[model samples]
Target: MAAESRSRILIIGVTGNLGFELAKASTAASHPTFGLVRDSAFSDPNKLQKIQNLSNHGVQIIKGSLQEEDGLIEALKQVDVVICAVASAQVLDQKLLISAIKRAGCIKRFFPSEFGGDPDRTRVSNLDHGFYSTKAEIRRLVEAEGIPYTYISCNFFASFLLPSLIQPGLQTLPRDKVNIFGDGNVKGVFVEESEVAAFTISAVDDPRTLNKVLYLRPPGNTLTMNEIVDIWEQKVGKHLVRNYISEEELLQKIHETPYPENMQMVFIYSVFVKGDQTYFDIASSNGVEGTQLYPLIKYTTVSEILGGML
Candidate 1:
């Protein structure tokens, strides 16, 4: 534990959900944690409050921007590991970070901003989704630079999907009706955000996970959309009218949706409907299962999430 604590950890985009959770977990584990915040974050009340909260929790703030190479290099000099939790759209900005890491020459481990589906298997020629493509590019850059790194392919975030599904949102799953894409039998692993953070922090110093893709599929967390809805119905003691959207309709949406968010959703829906999220099996000998590695870590399953929905 003392040796682990000696690892000075730094997280980019700490204002974001994953980054904040990772910072909190790192601090709780007695690791010397540092968070990078943009100078503009100090002006925004919400971001400022979050920064204060992180500070109160013992995270030192390194004020800078990804665009500024000099500032980034200076910041990198203070930490041994760099965990990037930046948004999908801002993933390309990691080029600047990669450059700084090479220049600083001190970071022992680099965890790129890949917290979603595996990009290697999800590529569609016409789709050109920057979310996945940009992440792939970053991976190439990290490898090209010969940086010691770990890429975490944490599948879908269960907490993120729960609210988006239950509440009145883009992909609405109302109390009385739920939308099912394709055959709805495709299984995908959905991990909670905090669990992803916990497992990630735990793996930072573990030599076994170095330069590997750490998968976050817990034992019971894998389930299809239909299976998830079924669990919800069993928990609520009420059935939801299932509405199936055919593959043709989803493909049309992907082509016609003008809004970037909606287009992204269509791409995501295609992934889930096609079962691309489960392309890699975490139980395989080559895979690093989070819960198995850290026996005491409790992963939140879809059943538990559905039961908590009110």
Candidate 2:
């Protein structure tokens, strides 16, 4: 079924920053969105409000915890496209998601949550997080089942680097001090959240994106952390401190942070540094530049992403 003709698009873990944005983008185009929330407590209030904000715009809020089979079954009812937007949902449990979708049996397409790093990398052989491993498993199951699915390998979120971390959240940092995990010159792809959402919506809307890793990301231009730090400092008119912390130091300091989540953040960054994960040339892969994600394709450059933030 074409996306617009479908009754609704179901977004699992809708109460997240990216999930909500994807729903809104689809709904804005008159495509009804069905969002499955894990539960009340796990749901983010701001993201919830964002959905309510779209109430008039045509979004269906379905309360379903990923832990409950009935919840997944009910949430997916009438869903034509399923977008898995969860973080750290283990591979074992992700089976529950796919099984439920199979039970619903109407799901035509799905977008896996492989949002960072290339799975083709040898470093991926050692991927440890429940997030990476779960996505890997889900992809495997989809292939085995011959279910229609799209694996979105977004390079990295630009916001993840600075606003989310590399700077603590609890206190206003004295400066946007950046920690360079690699040689401050590694060229890596980082995308803005809106750009990611736009590309995601386009993925489901376009049929050619199915059964492919619709690597929908912003401009492939990558910038070094040092370059960004320098520009932000210059634009903001202050020398935001730059700390060259060792991998060992970061691992230790992550424990020091009050946020328990920092531990995972540290590990993800460590993988980004050590893994063979980098930007892909989308124009060459799957034709995302032309047919899959034509209009929503946004390319953000290092200087522009940083300078705009400043």
Candidate 3:
């Protein structure tokens, strides 16, 4: 196939919420969007529903698994842009995505599966079970190669904290309650998943984001959970529960469970209660700093997001 214009984008993991949204936006924008589906899926009806919904949005689905080398390579050949929206826990599969993009020989840009907290030196250790290392390794391999890559180390997804809203129970850990890191004053960029896709495409479209580890960050209005709860208390019209936990205890829980979901629990236990601002994003919210193209991040507030959802 002849090389197409910059408008063509192939978004892998298209069935997921964020991927699905990006595909729709890209399609609405008139950019041809393709979705990659794993032929051997390990899920259920809702997941299938999401995938079927993609077809409704006019996204082309290429059935293949990241584990299938031949299949991945075949799918990569169909598009110039590739977004690995696969799960971070699938560290092994990430390597395959990179290899497939290379094998296709048509890919001009490759967006890795990283769409979460900063994996930079400061925050990587705090990321859930092995996800940080997996992301770091992928980024390392990309740097060594000549492939154009963008690592959107988008800071904490605000929506990821929705559990605390429905089940205020998570906001306070009764067991070995040592909240936040130290004094519970660490600030982090809390960008919504929706904003992440937008920022990602913006960063990817501008050639400057290529080959660079562009940190996808929310405009930091950094506030502790205690501070945030005060605002929420007013909104929910109830006394919000808040607590402080030691980082050491949180790490101990992680040491005990070591499961992805548990690791996330440890993180939530740490961030909201203890309120650590140790994490920071490299991508400038003002403009794409240091590169030729200026990339600006649009920050979404927690309340604003919840309001829309409710």
Mind giving the per-residue lDDT tens digits that candidate 3 earns over 168-278?
A: 237531222223334445554466676667667666566677776655433433465554555456555666344555666656666777465476655565454433323
Clashing pairs in 2: 38-65, 219-299, 219-300
Error of 1 at 257 (Å): 1.8
* Candidate 1: regions farther than 4 A off: 3-5, 164-173, 282-287
User: Candidate 1 — what's its lDDT?
Assistant: 0.82
Order of candidate numbers by TM-score, starting with the best:
1, 3, 2
All predictions: root-mean-square deviation over Cα? 2.2, 4.3, 5.0
Native-referenced Cα lDDT, model 3: 0.61
The sequence of per-residue lDDT tens digits that candidate 2 reaches over residues 1-310 is 5544744688776667777778787786567788776556346677667667656567777777667888788777767888877775433566878888888888888876666665544243332434455566677888888788887776667766544324444333235555566556544557776667777777676677777776643433455556656656766788765667665665566666655566444544544455344444555554344224575365565567656654
- Screening candidate 1 with a backbone cut-off below 3 angstroms (N, C-alpha, C), the clashing residue pairs are none
Count of steric clashes across candidates, in order: 0, 3, 11
The top-ranked prediction according to TM-score is 1
Candidate 1 weakest lDDT stretch, 10 residues: 164-173
lDDT of each: 0.82, 0.64, 0.61
lDDT score for residue 97 of model 1 = 95
